[model samples]
Target: MKKFDVLTPIGLVVGVVMLIFGIVTNGGITGFFSFIDPASLLIVLGGVIAGLLINFPVKDMKHIFTVIKQGFSQNEQNLDQLIKTFVTLSERARREGLLALEVEIEKVKDPFIRKGVLLAVDGIEPDMINDIMSAEITAMEERHRKGRNILEKAGEYAPAWGMIGTLIGLVLMLKNLNDPSSLGPNMAVALLTTLYGTLFANLVCLPLASKLALKTDQEVFLKQIIIEGVIGVQAGQNPKLLEEKLSAFLSSKERQKAAELITSGEALNDEA
Candidate 1:
C-alpha cells in the first residue's frame, strides 16, 4: 500500500515560509515584492528546462512529473504483516502441497509475490526462479536509477543556469552604467536568479532525488525479503525455520515489534 508522504510537502512549505519570514523580518511585507524578478525566474526556469530537454530524450522528459510524484508518496511496508503472510503460506504449502498455493495466490496483493509463488507452483527449478526474479529486481533498480538521474541533473542545471542569469544581469547592468536608476533593479535581478536557483536545487530537486533514492532502496530491501520467502516456500522448508530465516532480515526493534504483533494476534485467535 502507498500513502501520501507529508514530509516532502511540509519541508517545502516550511522552507518557503521561513524564507518569507526572514524577508518580512528584515524589510517588511512591501520589501518582499523587491525579490520578485520575473525575468530572472524565466531565465533560471527556462534554462533548466532547456538543459533537461537537451540532456534527456523526449520520452524520458514526459515522465518527469511522474517521477517527482513518487517523491510525495511512499509504500507502507509492514514487515510484521509480510512475515506473517509468508509463514502462513509456508504452512499451507507444507500441509496441502505446492499446487494448493494456487488458491492462496489470489489473496496476495503484490504482483512480485504472486509471480514468484506462481513460478514455484509451476514446478520451475529453484535456481531458475531465483535467476528470473533477480533479473526483475535488476530491471527495477535500473528504472529507478534513470528516474533519479533526471532529478539529479535538474539539481545540477539549476545552479549553473543561475550563474548564467547572474552574468546576463551583470552585463546588462554594465551596459546601463550611466542610468543610475537602472542599477538597483538590474542588480536585484542578478542576485535573485542565483537565490532562486540555489533554493530550487537544494530545497526541491536535490532533496526529492535523495528521497526517491532512499525509497528505491527500501523497496528493494522488501522485495529481497519476498524473494527469500518465496524460495523457502518452494523448497518446503520447515515453517518455523523459514520464519526464523526471514526474521533475520529485521532489526532488533523490528523483531520486538513483530513479536508483539504476533503475540497479540495469537491472543485474539484464542479469544475467538
Candidate 2:
C-alpha cells in the first residue's frame, strides 16, 4: 500500500512477481546467500544519509518527506470540478463587475484563487496581471525542479560511495590474506556495499525525484487555468464563450456539464 494504490497496483504486482521468478530460477535461497554482506551496506547507507544532510536544509528535507508521504495516498482530482469552479467564478465576475467582488476575493480559501480574484477585482490590466502570474508560476516550477535535482544528485553519489566502501573493505581483506578466518569478514563488506547502493538508488532516491517532477508539471497546468480564466472574466468576455475556453482545461465529461449549464439544460445553485 505504501508503494502503490489501486491506480498503479498491476504494474507493481508484475514487477514483484518477475523479481521472485528470477530469484527462484537462479537457485533461490542458495543464490541469495551470496549477496549478504553487512559492511557494504554500512558504507552505502552512511554515505547516502551524510550526503542528504549536507546538501539539503532541514526545512527542505521535511518537505521532501511530506511529498513522499502524500504521493502514495493523494487522491485523483476530477477535472470536471475544476472546470465548474472556473465557470462559476467567471459568471459571477461578469454579473457583479469587478468592484462588487472585493468581498469574494477576501473570502476565497486557496491562496492562488485569492490572488487571482484580488487582481481581477482591482481592475488590473489583464495582460500585465497575466505576465506577473506567469512569471510567478515559472519560478515555482523552478523550485520544484531544484528539489528533484537534489535527490537525483544524491542517488548518483550513493552508488559511488558504495564503491568507495568496497575499496576500503578490499584493502583490509588483502592485508589479512594470510588468515582464512579474516578473509570472510572482508569479503562480506565488499559485497554488502554494492547491494546497499543498488537498493537505495532504485527503491528510494530515484523514485522520489521522478514523482516530484511529475507533481510539478501537474501544478503548473492547474495554475495556468486560473490565470486564463480570471483574465477572461476581467475582460468581460461572453459568459458562454468564457465557459468554452475554461472548459478546455477539463476532460470531455466536465466540458459537457459546462455546456449544459450554458445551454440552460442544467440549473446550478451558485448562479443567481
Candidate 2 C-alpha lDDT tens digits along 1-272: 12344433454466556765776789687766666666577688788878888887887777775655544543344444445555656667778777766665554444666687688777788888898899989999887776787678778888888788778889999999999998878877876787678766766678767866776777788788878877887887776687778777777876786666555533322321
Task: Give the top-scoring candidate (TM-score).
Answer: 1
Question: Model 1 misses residue 194 by how many Å?
Answer: 0.6
Model 1 lDDT tens row, 170-241: 998999999999999889888999999999999999999999999999989998999999999999999778
In terms of lDDT, which candidate is strongest? Answer: 1
Query: TM-score per candidate, in order?
Result: 0.95, 0.79
Off by over 4 Å in 1: 260-272
What is the TM-score (0 to 1) of candidate 2? 0.79
